[model samples]
Target: MTAISTALPAMSRRDEIWHGLRDTFPMMVGALPFGVIFGTLATAQGLSPLQVMSMSLFVFSGSAQFIAVGLVTSSALWVIWAATFIINLRHLLYAANLVNHVRHLPQYWRFPLAAMLTDETFAVMELRYRQRGSEGYAHWYYLASCIGMWLNWNFWTLVGLVVGQSFPDLKSLGLEFAMVATFIGIVIPGLKTKPLWAAAITAGLVATLLHHLPYQSGLMLGALAGVGIGLVLDLRRKKLEASVYE
Candidate 1:
């Protein structure tokens, strides 16, 4: 208890809020290029500025928005939905893990936090929860982090729209790779365990092999297969550990 107490910083609410934004700044930076790329692609896809801006404001999922941009004309509606849903399945795990920490909060607080929650927010918030054990004004930190990311994304999306409109071929500049780079940074660090390894590797292989499929169905299939395989392996591992303990 003493060690844990000493390890967790005792900071003011203002400090926590600042730390939330300050700590997440790198993640924000990583995502900036992605935001610009998305805005460029969406506008290039013939979506109006209002539509592009609304998507950023409301959807806010970089991965999903990118999928929508690529598939809006080529893929069916159901395919887009499935692709986004599969990509976002990780958020379910994120929410489940963080639920206990915020269970004491009112519905109003939990609702917005849930809505604004992203990979970056979850990464930082999980670390914060671990360090502080959910004490102090941690949710304020969460809120501020969300606010910072949300604003960053929307702002860049607008910039992309403006620049892409002027250039009209910004998407052809081989810039979409920024999303790939950002995602690699976000995902690679989390593949410490076996299940995560299986999921990522399997997803990549399957998505690659099935890339010829129409409507970007490969992504949905690969993601589903990877999640399913990872879950099975995780469950088996847990059962084996339990039996050993027993």
Candidate 2:
């Protein structure tokens, strides 16, 4: 009976991981072209295949990689690093939000999970945490999602790097639009609350107005603006609720 009980839990956890992978498949479809496009553009910008793959492997940040590529030629090394750092500041917010759930995990488990974190994985994992409330096995689900995205990104990156060698004009095909459309798909469904809608609008307007900013600093500014607005509104709502309860 003891052995059976242990085996049952293991089986259940495996099921959770499988579910996470299944849920992430849709997002992977969107990320596929984005990764390929990055690979294509990076090579066009004079990055060797090894360098391109290394960036994807080690950094695992889509926006930062893109920004780095743009700044690589004309900008100083520090400038490229700083631009990518600023653009990825939003990950801090994602980590803060998820800290409570993963804090109990050991360093071994937590480190890789943290390393694999990305915008798309965060979105899906956040939704899962809300629904399931971070029972111990949730990390396994997160792991599955992270691994799915990591593999998807690396695989498509290789595809792009190989194909780009033959067709130098591959980027001109406008396939990057797939990434934009995918983001729309991801963002629209998450706007269930007033704060979310307000934040999205604020960020969109700020980014659009500041689109000409160098090194994509506009994106960082827009993200900060949206987060600030959302936080203020959320706090005000909480204060109002507290007053009503009192």
Candidate 3:
């Protein structure tokens, strides 16, 4: 109903779609190598081509899928569940803004967009909404951006599968760090809140302290502790706000 790209003078629906794809380029740069690394390494870790590709298509979370692949054999299923859940908790923050943007749309529109939503999509979409203001067919931009990323991730994963089957040692390329870089780009800007910064620092510290633990259980414990602490602080802030309002 409203033009989300109000800032951009005038543009057609197709143009908006292309603009969404164009704007997501920088994010795709970071995701490209990460997807390849997952494709290459996941199979080596005992996942079949079907399973790996299914993860990209269905799970569709770069960090969480990587973690799942890494833990698929060594850790228990519960561990994989807990770890990926913690890793994806960051999406909650992203979803808050996302829901507000798409709240006006129908279920058909919102469901897929929310399902395929990622850190990169959220960041770019947030910027678009804030800078441009959603007034027209901005949902097309949102949808196009998401589809662009989804296709990019799936394509690279297939390439990794094809190439990794032949080479078997792409991990040695040190290309995995690209995702880490992408995460930093995602997190640093969002650390505007005290709870987020505190949780991040605490999670790292606790995980590092417990790094020597068996099955890497320390990482999960540390993450739990960080989440606990963050929730406490957030609740306290909410009460204070409510008291002030009263």
Best by TM-score: 2
The CA lDDT at 63 in model 1 is 84
Error of 3 at 112 (Å): 0.6
What's the CA RMSD for each of the models?
A: 3.5, 4.1, 4.9
Ranking 1 against 2 by lDDT, winner: 2
lDDT of 3 by residue, 1-246 (tens): 873535467567998899999999888888998889889989898889999999999999988898898888888889888888877876776788667778889999988888988989998898888877775778899989999999999999999988899999887999978877987887788677888788888888999999988556676778778888888888999999999999
Q: Would you give me the overall lDDT of model 1?
A: 0.87
Residue 108, candidate 2: Cα error in Å is 0.7
Model 1 Cα lDDT, one tens digit per residue, 28-83: 88788788888988998989999999999999999889889888998889989988
Give per-residue lDDT, candidate 2, residue 151: 96
lDDT of every predicted structure (CA atoms): 0.87, 0.87, 0.86
Which digits, one per residue and each the tens of the lDDT, describe model 2 over residues 1-246? 243322223337888899889989988998998888889889999999899999999999988899888878888999988888878888988999899989899999999989999988998988887766677588889999999999999999999899888887887888788878877988998899888888999999998899899767788789889888988988898999999999
The predicted structure with the larger lDDT, 2 or 3, is: 2
| Per-residue lDDT value at 18 in model 1 | 96
Against the true structure, whose lDDT is highest?
2
Between candidates 1 and 2, the TM-score winner:
2
Candidate 1 global Cα RMSD: 3.5
